[model samples]
Target: MPQKDYVKTARPKPKAKPRASNARRGNARPTQGANRPWLLIIITALLLGSFGWFLWYLKQQPANPQQPPAEVSKSKPVVDDLPVKPVAEPYQYIKELENKEVQVEVDTTEREPQGPFQMQCGSFRQAEQAEAMRAQIAFAGFASAVRRTEGTNGIWYRVVLGPYDSKRQATADRNRLQQQNINGCRIWNWT
Candidate 1:
């Protein structure tokens, strides 16, 4: 038995082709028209619309010009010149006015004791300071007096203004104290 020999074969090469021209292949110019006419038409339409709007604005404006306001006339008041007469009195006479009134003797009774309302301004540690403030208040034409009272902490000397019947009067007095440049003075209702 003999082995047969195998040989390799070479194939023929392909030739290079030439490039085609665009003009001969009908690919040079554009088939569609230019867009300048459409743009011009849009611009013309916008201009016509704006012109119509301006015409409508001119028609909406008032035709007559504005005029100034008229002046108002003030007339003088007329009064009567006749002599005035007095009218009759409403109350002329009273019958048995003194006889009908009852005559009774007035009783002079003694007045009851009145309790004063005490307003506490502040508690001072020193009695001298309280006394000094009391003196100042007294000198200011106020009937002021100082009283010593015992508190839970210690003894307190209270400077009181008066037994003012009303809180309004007491507040007025307090304001007067403030006007006098007196600090640490406040209104207190002491009943």
Candidate 2:
């Protein structure tokens, strides 16, 4: 194949229109728009009339007119007899429990003394669940015991953490378990 030589062709330049003389430019024809004097007058008159009407309407009435005397009722019902409340007397026995000492009398009807308190974190039907709860409690730095108790409603495995000397200690342990995201632990007397 022979390689042919390519020649670049020149493009035709566009000619500019000749500028008119200053005198002819000044005398150039105005736009041939229709003479609408009636339309212009009517539009101007309407705008002025509407503005005047709005002003007149505003002046005719107040922004907030006072209500007439007949519209407002002068009579309001008066309370004839109001109930008299009896003065509340302060009860004598609401002393500060922490500051005051409470003495319990030993009664003949009381057969046995109160036992140590215990906290039961969970009660499960399966022993494995009880063991898991105990393991969770152990991870939370608590030693727990799982006991299998047979009742009317089948057997139940209880996860307990007690034999606490006082109920306060049991409550504290329960609160600590709650802090470890273990909830629903109730403190009761350990049998």
Candidate 3:
């Protein structure tokens, strides 16, 4: 069997056609005119329905009440036309306090010369007893001291309560010492 080869042939190109101008189509007026009847129908229906709704809403409202008096509606206040009130003096209240009698009592007893005071909790011949007293005083929240002094008999250790600022403070220390069952506490003057 023999095979045949196909030959390709070129045809002439198609001629360019001329297009019609839009001006010659007379501006397409008829199709636009056809839409007007339906558009008018829709607009008329909307207007009638809105008029019906407005009529219904008008019937739903309550009857109007009598109008308010003109004087109450005026923007300026009636108080502005009235006379002003007189104000009382600012310091008038102080005169009442000045009239009341106040009696002041002054202390007559001379205060002791300003020196730190001390309370003697115990006088012991033994240093250990004095140290023990000092420890007990410290545990009771007071700072105490042990002073060694030579007496007529021998050197003694004195457990002192405080170097307090005033006699009343020293008295309070003596009371505290009494609470601790050491009733022989004495107040002493110290510079």
Candidate 4:
């Protein structure tokens, strides 16, 4: 084969076609940063305008000087009524209540406790455990005592609350302990 000289012809570079969005918008195509400064300027102008309006509004308002708190006066209250209302008949309930003996007849009579009530918080074999429980109960604001009682099982230490005058009082104390998350307190008649 005869040697053939080959020429690498550089075809005209294809013109970069405009993007579809840019082509549709034409000259209105937004630049990466063109509106940034304008936005800042507009926002700044709005803020300044608002501040100026606030200053003008403040100037328009009548200045109310702060007055010292007035002492309660013993004078009759000033009424601003066109028609003088007949002085409201003086409150008669107070006078009637003073003379009236309100006999509140309690309909239900609760059965009273037979004797002084007591609350037994816990019975423990060890004195130390009983003392620790008593300390915890004391922390909750109740005075408790650890009494050592010899039972058929063995010597047991009882953590007792009180010789409460009433069952209601003993229940109240137990409820208070319950609020402190202490459970298993039994109310018994104190010997």
lDDT of 1: 0.73
Candidate 4 residue-wise lDDT, 63-176, digit = tens:
675865557667868657797678777688987988998778786988865898889999999999999999999999999999999989899999998898988999998999
Kindly state the number of residue pairs that clash in model 3.
Answer: 0
Give candidate 4 misplaced runs (Cα > 4 Å).
Answer: 1-113
Question: What is the per-residue lDDT of model 2 for residues 1-191, given as tens digits with 9 covering 90 to 100?
Answer: 98764543355558899998756889755554556577888999999999999999999996667855445446865556978775874664565554788799877785555779888899999999999999999999999999999999999999998799888888888888899999999988877
Our tally of clashes for model 2 stands at 0
Report lDDT per candidate.
0.73, 0.85, 0.82, 0.87
Worst 10 residues of 3 by lDDT: 4-13
Clash totals for all candidate models: 2, 0, 0, 0
**Clash pairs for candidate 1:** 117-190, 118-190
Model 3, span 85-176: residue lDDT tens: 76876677689888988899999999767788888889999999999988888777788889999978999999887688898989987787
TM-score each candidate.
0.38, 0.41, 0.40, 0.43
Error of 1 at 178 (Å): 0.7
Q: After superposition, how far is residue 143 of candidate 1 from its true place, in Å?
A: 1.6
Candidate number of the best TM-score: 4
1-191: candidate 1 lDDT, tens digit per residue: 77654442254456789877878898986445463678789999999999999999999977765965646567855658998776965564454564576779988997663545555555667899888888787767677777888989998888877677766777787778778877677665564
What does candidate 4 score on TM?
Answer: 0.43
lDDT of 2 at 59: 95
